[model samples]
Target: MSSLIEGYNYDIFISYCQKDNKHDGWVTEFVDNLKGELESTFKEEISVYFDINPHDGLLETHDVDESLKEKLKCLVFIPIISRTYCDQRSFAWEHEFIAFVEQASKDQFGLKVKLPNGNVAGRVLPVRIYDLDDNDVRLYESVLDTVLRGIEFIYREPGVNRPLKPDDDEKINLNRTKYRNQINKTANAVRDVITALEHYDHEPVTVAKDIFKPASIPSETGKTKIVTGSLILLALIVLGFFLLPKLLKSEGEPEKTIAVLLFQNYSGDPSQEYMCNGLTNEIIGHLYKIKSFDRVVPIDYVLPYRGTDKKPSRIADELKVNYILSGNFNTTRDTVRITAHLIDPRKDKILWQNGFDQPYKRIITIPADIATQIADCLKTNLTALEKQNIERIPTTNLEAYQLIQQTKNQFNTRTYESLNQLYDLSLKAIDLDPGYADAYAGAGSMLILTGTTFQHTAMQTVIEDALKLWRKALELDQNNASAHCGLALYNDWIIWDYIRAEEEFLKAIELSPNNQSFMKGYSEFLQKRNRLEDARAYKVKAEDDPIRIDILSLVLSGEKDEAHKYLNTYLQSKKIFAGEYFIWLEDYEAAKSICEAALQKKSQSMLAPRYQACLALAYYKTNDHHKAQMIIDQLIEKSDISLAGSPEFYTGWYYSGIGKIDSAFYWLEKAYKNRCPEIPWLKVDPGFKNIRSDDRYWDLYERAGHKAYDDYRAGLKRRKSNR
Candidate 1:
């Protein structure tokens, strides 16, 4: 009978006693509503098995239906537990629940699967319409050896408990909401289990112990208890040895990768370019809420594709994605028309396409609808929570959303005035809509970027303001990934709370794992702690992002040559990186040449002093102390007024390179106090290794919140010995 069905015969099997169905037909109505919701939730047709005929008992001589036995191979076994259902030991309990339980016991019975919250949950889901008695709970929990958790449908009034009906909520107005919530929960749970099962890689599960077979008639009550107890004991042993370990590992598969291409401007008016760009950016943001995607190429990365004559497959290869989403937008007098197409680049096929032509006021709905449609076409298993997150529009105010999108477009312009202007725009967005979460997140990011702007406020005051803005953003939308990422940066750099910063970064990644900003921050955080291998893994996870490729993990891992090769191949302006690498390799001539070339290219750039300092370091290494000293003196005078934080850090570098240990420590401490951005590179930057033998160097390292893996291992060893 089990062999009759392939992967899954039914999406869900609803088991209930006939008496519940007779009681105002609650079961029938519930099934009907569930079917309707299933249709709306799933792209494919959902097959649900609900036996309507009342068969109170199954006699020993009564022939069992082969079709019923075949239908038991369902993805989800939703036992509609009620007082009558729990008390009976007939077809509901025997053939429906126990039969499937026995079959699963022979498979990976207790292997925990990943949940939407990055946790794990079991497979057997229950829908409770009546309170479970002690016996009812024992029978189920014994076989599973876990709590009998379910989506409970019993409504508790002041002193009464009753099954929730679809139309019974006149006073509280919560019955319908509760029912819908449970349905959604059940549907999403089934999806989670199926996804985990499809992706899980592990040893085969088998029952080594004796298998108990039921007689022609069901087992006697005492015998049933013994059988169930033995199964529970064996399950405990299996779980202790197997399932517990698998819970810590993730299920693996080909990652769901996507790239959002630049939206074409069909709006004839070139002055409305901002609107078209904003719409494209907003669509990307909405798509980011779909946690199923492993990568979503950010707007900046895909901007080059706007006018290029590249094929979808070629662009997909460049972006390293399985799918590409491109669209066109036209803004008319009172309406906007947006068309979206999702292409499978491997086959150069259009998998899904849709268009929305709506009034300007209703424009906010377009992104959500487009994201949902793409997910449906890709067959992405979105949980109810993820679906709600994807559908949530940031704000109803078009001006607020438009302003925030414009800020995203201009965020890369990291000038003092440009960033301050972006901050002002964010404030304007918030004024238009006080509850806009993205506006607050945008404002916080701009404040963080323009931290050195003396035109507005001090760095400390800017940090505090940015922190508050991010907090407000989280208050408005707790699941805002950008808000979490901004807070992660604040905690890491300003507050120096390494543990809290890591937690925030991880939370942001969990909310939107494909976001490059979160991935880069996490990589830098791991690097700061001197976890080079761990940092490298995160760097590779975000390798599609050009900015993230400049991490120091490769050089720190003693692969400086590999780093140099990558820079030589990938970066067009590789002189600065090559100079850094040559300094690490002790090739003074090569380092000096690279630095001189970089300075010649941009003698007036903000980083010119840093290049000059590097050249001086190379000069000192090559036994040219006279030239090195002259250049260092010129830099110390010329960079005295530079607003950029590089002057302090490079001054320390020049001193350190010339073997002036005390002077190096003084300038390094000054840079640390000044909150130079280069402080994060202290652990991996080879220049700092010169003074590692000094106590002051260790003190500075500790102040920078650095730690090694050996430190953690030593702590573990101490705890173990104490125990």
Candidate 2:
């Protein structure tokens, strides 16, 4: 299609570097969306000159300039501005962007136009994907000889800089811009420029120059022809303003963030809650796959509100989300009924409500269908990859799918017994469907968790099984987030391979950014690597449980007073583990008091093992050798089975505190052999001060990459001192 006006080959010319689309295909997606928007915006077919297959289209003998010159005779020019697009040597910048500007300036319109609303506008519209430096901004301005302003599609967050996607939550995005809304604005702006060009080309509507300005209105009646034409022009302008749909709105659109709660189990059978909850997560999983949809709350964050009758607005406020999706899942003997609602909690508005009644066999596909509809209702763009992910069924065997859902519920329980059950259920799922990647990951994750938490499992066996399971899971489906995280754990704990572990952790994060569980593990990995500032940044972001904050106070390095303040607040309700904080602060008396009280209250419960170790450390520090010895004996007996972590490290610390140098070294060696999670932080832990001056301690530290830690900390200190 050609331009609406004669003598032009295209209506809009899109200029961008080929490299911009190499990885994410960002520029190609932008141009495709623009074409779709233009089709809806214009009654005439709008031609876009996008060099998508330039290599194939432009042969070696083809005169590229002659071909581009005809296409460059366009009404509007859109240059996708990026960090790389500013180079004067690039073909897009030199031949296309600059060439169009110079060519258009010599044309009759002179690159600027007078709108019917009496406002001046530019024909060159720049779509910015990355924020430019001052020098690039000056280069762009120097060409136009005017201030630069256009649409922005940049996604900004702490330590994140990328192009905005259709799914980015405007509430969380600092730019407060939506991709769909920006596309509409571009379409409308294109309409305005085209309309102005048409008027000038026809030499019609002279009143349009100052139609809205009272000062420009003539007072004389002698020029009756001009006055009569002004009235006709005024009438048409008013008519078009009211009749035009796309131009009426696009600016100041409300920011939105959504939380998906578990689907209410109304099947009247309690056994079906697993299916309901699975449907909820599957829907969330589909949404997460859509990179454009960036702000759906993670499942762990919504688990607390599972069966509540709390109002959507209240739930949204508590979760710091603007939208909520809640629904009911009911089933009969042969049929299932599902109802879902997407609501704007702040306005108490139901944006979209849907219900489906289908055969129970169809339940496997409902989640993806609902996910696609929700994305459409929210007006988020669905990339080809996202669409494929949503439509792709994980497992066709209903029984196997059910077992995976059961595994999900079991993993959420997270007790020692529950983890074992989850692992068994995963095996059953794999038996039912050998190709299911999630099932393999589920079983492998249990091995990682149990090995790291309970050192009784054979270290070499867990390492072998974990490696095989995680690798198999990824071989089947490389996009499996759990599989990536599992491999990351295997590398971190088993072989102590920090480089490969970091890569797998990043892979998991890239695949599933909303998974707080993955974020928690990654943060711990970062902490052990001595990147404390980056670690705490992600630790605070992964906020599914309050107890994790309790752990953060111990791991994060900062003001001693601040850590004490957090411990005090934690002790008001959670007093059992105060000794660890007291030990960290070197307040032996306070630690002994807290741990003594805790052991007296819950000596026989699960808290026994944790409080026992803490109290023993306190006893040794206070010079009560007899009591410390007895407590350490009991702790050693129960150490292998403790659900609480790091009993091995604590035992080693206790031996060091008592000045039993040989015993302390023996325990520390055992701890390192078992791949105790705390072994990586041996160099900086405060409890090992008594042993730090010893030659053996230095040997162990160097073995655990102490030199690397020192280098990382030195760089981190220079980059960030607050942590």
Candidate 3:
């Protein structure tokens, strides 16, 4: 029998303070409302398990470990941070919060096996239900600084009347608005942090140094010493001219290469861990605008060496780059000091270095100054408008600046919890200054991530809210690329308005040419329109990250060998699993094998679901219909209906393999109508060779809108004749 609860799969795990629950039943009420909202939002009636439930049989039977283990196996820990919640004695707080952090870190960084038993743990969602002072949070300062740095903390107004009370609709509405805004901000923050963590773990170092070296001191006879010094200098110059170009050649082009290293944190408070990342992102954003530069990779590409014993020269050699830029920020209460250096990687010497200090508000101009300084050193000309654009600050508010940094951190993490955190933070920034367009844009992105992950019940509402926020953002700032991209994605996925999506995507690309997301999204749009050549071209122009390049190459070539080669290089460089890379090669069997191996090493990965789907497809392809059906059925039952598409596509393949022509046609028709790119392979696929002679097969092929198939053959003959 097909079962939904074959094993303990958790929807939510509630972490709350027993003390807070003691007074006025606040925790209980919050839990009830949250459960209702999640269930209503996802359309799945999920069981909400709490650590503090008094009548729990597991507690009485001394099976807390076993029960909690099972609970953790299927759990998404929701930490409710309040004043009392942060209290160390709160066992509910300690057990849940610690366990959640450990699990989440393991899931994210693959750190599960570090424990004694070497079992992987699940992820956690830290939800702040009430306000807590900095001091209260400080008690668990280390934990907060590490796991909860980018988490969304939902806060309710203190002394607000209870919702259960009569005639409290006004307060309830106010509180609901507050909670909604908080929830939205947290959601956004969670998404940002998760995305950052997933993508930006490596920091790229841009080589910076003083180009003009100090002249060597002369001996007593200065005139006589000039001969030796001049000869030495001349020889050095000659050696550089002959050898530098040959040594610094990149893979394709030999343009100036730059790497933005991790920014130094000036903030003395260790809790403010995101400041360095924020600074790094800002510099990267500015540099990304210079189109004349052939390649500018982010420090994130080299994150594996963070805190390692490797030198900058070693890293540069591995990346095969020419330059590295390093910087430090020192900030006081009212002033900020910044120092930066550019180095030549080949020479292992500093080419340029500079320092600047200014009032906190004036730090925005640092980008232009740094850019101009580096440009002068490199002998690259920058237009006046580019200089002005570099200096421009989107917002003057310090809070907004801080919020942007926090949002960026959260965005990079790319987990559900991180998305929620980003949303909450962005919402708070918006509330602080409703005129802040970027905050709204960030919130919209959070909504999109959330909808993409959960994809049911409240998805429409979430997406609509995202659109409204993006529109509001654009209304405030017409040229906001982030807002434009957010709207484009919203239109493309939720609304299915491809034309509008295309327009917005183009506008975003025009505004921010080097933005990786915009490039990838635009490429996908081109592919959707059957513009494969255009898609391939754009994919080449997009950022050359391992995952992105691998997927793009697979889409363009459909050659497993090429895909595998690229994926192997990527794996060697990154020293990590590339799950999506395996999927792109259509080597589902290999992908499934790797994922299973990873799971055995660290079982609690969210990647399991995605890989499970891949395995099902592989089984279907190999004609193991029963196994494929079993896996697909389980996935459909456990996951959202959107997951049903893949299984359905495979079902058609299975039917076709067994000579069920009518059923095969039914499935293939559905797949083709959905514009499944994989559907085209059916025309040339050996699995369906049996049906090639059928007249109905030709009709189905025509229905798939591949007129180019005939055109390509004719063009081939014409080209041969001409040759």
Tens-place lDDT per residue, model 1, 497-521, is 5555665687687677567767777
Model 3 gets an lDDT of: 0.57
lDDT of each: 0.69, 0.72, 0.57
Q: What local lDDT does model 3 show for residue 297?
A: 70
Query: lDDT of candidate 2 vs native?
Result: 0.72
**Model 1 TM:** 0.62
Query: Which parts of model 1 have CA positions greater than 4 angstroms off?
Result: 1-255, 308-310, 345-348, 412-417, 451-461, 544-574, 603-609, 634-643, 707-723
In terms of TM-score, how similar is model 2 to the real structure?
0.61
Regions of candidate 2 where Cα sits further than 4 Å from its true position: 1-255, 290-294, 304-307, 381-387, 413-417, 452-463, 544-558, 603-611, 635-648, 658-662, 706-723
Residue pairs of candidate 1 with colliding backbone atoms = none
Q: After superposition, how far is residue 710 of candidate 1 from its true place, in Å?
A: 7.7
Worst 10 residues of 3 by lDDT: 111-120
Task: Sort all candidates by lDDT, best to worst.
Answer: 2, 1, 3
Q: After superposition, how far is residue 262 of candidate 2 from its true place, in Å?
A: 2.3
How far residue 384's Cα lies from its native spot in candidate 3, in Å, is: 5.6
CA displacement after TM-score superposition, residue 577 of candidate 2 (Å): 3.8
